[model samples]
Target: MSALPVIDIHTGAAPVLRETVLEFDQVAVQLGGRQILSPTSLKIGRGEFITIIGPSGCGKTTLLRAAAGFVRPEGGAVLRQGRLVGGPSREVAFVFQDYAHALLPWRTVQGNVELALEAAQVPATERAPRAQQVLQTVGLAAHAAKFPAQLSGGMQQRVQIARCLAQQPELMMMDEPFGALDAMTREGLQDELARLVRETGLTVLFVTHDLEEAIYLADRVVALRANPTAERPSLARVIDVNLPRPREQLATKEHPEFLRLRRELYGYLGHGHG
Candidate 1:
């Protein structure tokens, strides 16, 4: 393992020293004779907004899935609150890229949000109000009775977000949640997501291919190296963002600091603008 720098944010809570919420300990993943991830390691503190960015085959999504318990690491470990992640925990929620497959068509927006609570066997009397509150947070409470087909692509994604939120998950793992939407819609949802994270103090691990999106949303951007199985593997890099909090669409993107950070991230990804 390379010498990695650690950053700490004190939450002033006892029983936990420094509050290391999620830790990936030298994780190496292999699938189908291919090295999906190579001895990767990272530590995310509570309430952090971490964005993972990398090239297509660099295992960004795979890492997220592993964190969500969909895949296991061949080496190293995935930990949540100092415990090894054996399976899907109630505290970790996943939002997939494809909303169509993630949500059931037969279930209404509200129903989709309530499915997790239902599986947990939350009392029926409390499900509606909980579901409604989350939907409202995603700006979809009015569309509760509507089905996925009745909403736009953005709205469907909102439902997905609402569904995850209703679980009251302390950790949210989102894999390119807005990649399928139009630019305007993507930006709109991005703002909404930032708001939700701030309001709920959700610890987010978001994966995206878009550098601008990464810079705009993340407190730190972790860039993955090239495929480890490749003839020559690149180096993994992490860029710390010092931008001030409470990011908005226009103000954040247009800020001089945002551009500088974006440029640095692109450079770390081996991209340079002429």
Candidate 2:
């Protein structure tokens, strides 16, 4: 077998066309004789944050999974660093929509994060410190010994993120990770997640139903077509967000470029121009 490809995320110093990290070449997916994703194509550059938005059942999550090797397509290819992906490799980590199912009920927050490292075959002696470091990164250091039952919903999701961070995967695939949280908590974690991505230089492929969330977090947003199983899902044009980095939620949202991007993103999802 050939070596699994390792994708490099661009840190914004060079032009996008010169540093394409992830590419989809006329990719299509189907299940039970019904088409899920249409002939979609995109190239995600290194260090770029991409958010995918659409109505429910629009194959946004499926496309993210395909890139993570969870959903293999019936046609076309997903290339990482210009090489085809065959299966689940260590280079990718997926944060599921359901945090309750994603975390282990019996494991403490630290143990859960440690388990990810163990599964990745990280040595036993190195696991504790690695887990602790990631927990710090996600701002869950105090809850290390606490079980999932002891923490609130948002904290549990942080533990989930810490686990993924512990693995230190090259490409992070998130499927509505904050969808289940309340408004305040959701906003807080959204900022935290953006900070983590920027500080750690991790490339993200996030799937969300919220257009505002897409505008706030993504360097570019890709909108999907609705009713994926009934008809092939399509990719609307990529909306570029060139807002200033290290963005604050309130300030970034208030910016003119942010509003313009939000409006364009909404329109792509079949909303209005005004």
Candidate 3:
């Protein structure tokens, strides 16, 4: 509590906060003439792990896409490292939930991870070592030569993460990345991902429907509300987790603060299917 800057995103937290990595200034979006997000604003600091959760159609994915420059906002703006995010950049890496479609089945694990370096035009010789390093970081070094078809769902997802790491991005956008994994597998990867993000010091904006996942992995949880109006805006609330680092799936989930936050956020999710 003393040194940690787990402060509200929309409020006064800059003094103790790290350098801003991403900023959403009155951001809004619409689809098919319907407003997807209201005028929203949040400042995300470097190395922060922010999780977004809300009901279905609440623009969780839309907000994340906007941050990554994959979606254009109808109003307001998204700034990355003080520059307006007009389009996707090599410094930003996106991790899709569907690992099956995200990875190229024709390529080996190492080859897929090398795609990022290839896109950046890194030398062919440099790509190998970089790809291998990230693969090893994700514990997939032994499976480098294996094809995506040969790996399990969790392993495939790990490859996808490894690929993002190879890009050496300043920000990582994860959209319900563990949503498709089994309960056990999801918990395991949650730990692995938390560890990876900590070690790499990459700022992450993660979207999830799971209440516990949102609480366990976030420095602050941004809860959005669907079908926004002036009375009920899209950005419902942002709560600081304030929990210690290196969260354990079992122990952290059972922590008093964790349970309290879970109970607090459960109401917004409405049966947790969102």
Candidate 4:
């Protein structure tokens, strides 16, 4: 098998060939009379898989939502391809954790995927083929006629992912997408998602509480802290996962670098740091 075109981000050198697709320039968010996310700054390169991991209420979801233009920031700005993102666009796709609720019960897998193209005003003649293509990409072409209720949890999540792919978004914002699945299913979906990202070169911003998951999926992990003050800001630390691509659950976890990263990030969570 040919090697996947994975970016060598752990080299600690700037990737001059890659372009910055999303940028958060001192972005801050406030909710319900309290600051949810303190001014945070980061640049996401095209095709970068960035995972945001922190404590339960560290505004990880808020940061992802802000990037999707669902939450308005109280300060600073979010830029997409050098342009400021004022509102949601088709270029940005969001995947929620609750796959059960995210998919329409009335619609079949293919129909649900069609909704994305329909919303984008894709020609009626082009919807079916596009939907089927994405379904096949996610390994769900055989189950396209099945409804969300009829499919398993992992299959239902694949439908949601296919729908996102149908939209052909430049950036994918996923909020704990695999959190609801069982351990084995979660690992399967992780490998599948990594493969999809490698094939499509999609830039993803995923939020999760699982440290191992973060280390496994991310090129760089951003750890956030809640209730930020000037002394202790929301952006805690950003760690580079230097492990090579095509990571396996058994072999990759046993690697020395992965062990060191796991140990390093373990201290950031549940250690009164966040």
TM-score of each: 0.90, 0.90, 0.93, 0.93
Order the candidates by TM-score, highest first: 4, 3, 2, 1
**Candidate 4 lDDT by residue in tens digits, 27-46:** 98999988888888898888
- Clashing pairs for model 3 are none
| Ranking 1 against 4 by lDDT, winner | 4
Residue 118 accuracy (lDDT) in model 4: 97
Off by over 4 Å in 4: 1-15, 271-274
Candidate 1 lDDT tens digits, 1-274: 1222334323323333336788898877788967888787788877788998888877888898888888998888998888899888889999988999999999999999999889778999999999998888888888999999999999999999988888889899999999999999999998899888988889999988888899888878888876575444322777777666677778888999899988777776776211
Alpha-carbon lDDT, every model: 0.83, 0.83, 0.88, 0.89
How displaced is residue 249 in candidate 4, in Å?
A: 1.4
To one decimal, what is the Cα RMSD in angstroms of model 4 from the true structure? 4.2
On TM-score, who's better, 2 or 4? 4
The residue-by-residue lDDT of candidate 3 on 1-274, one tens digit each, is: 1123445432435546478889999998888988888899998888889999888887888998899998899899999878899998888999999999999999999999999899999999999999988998989999999999999999999999999988899999999999999999999999999999888889999999888899999999999887887567799999988777778878888899998888888865668446
* Model 1 TM-score, 2 decimals: 0.90
Reference-based lDDT, residue 234, model 2: 74
Give candidate 2 misplaced runs (Cα > 4 Å).
Answer: 1-18, 228-233, 271-274
User: Model 1 residue 119 lDDT?
Assistant: 79
**Top lDDT hit:** 4
Q: How close is candidate 2 to the true structure, as a TM-score?
A: 0.90
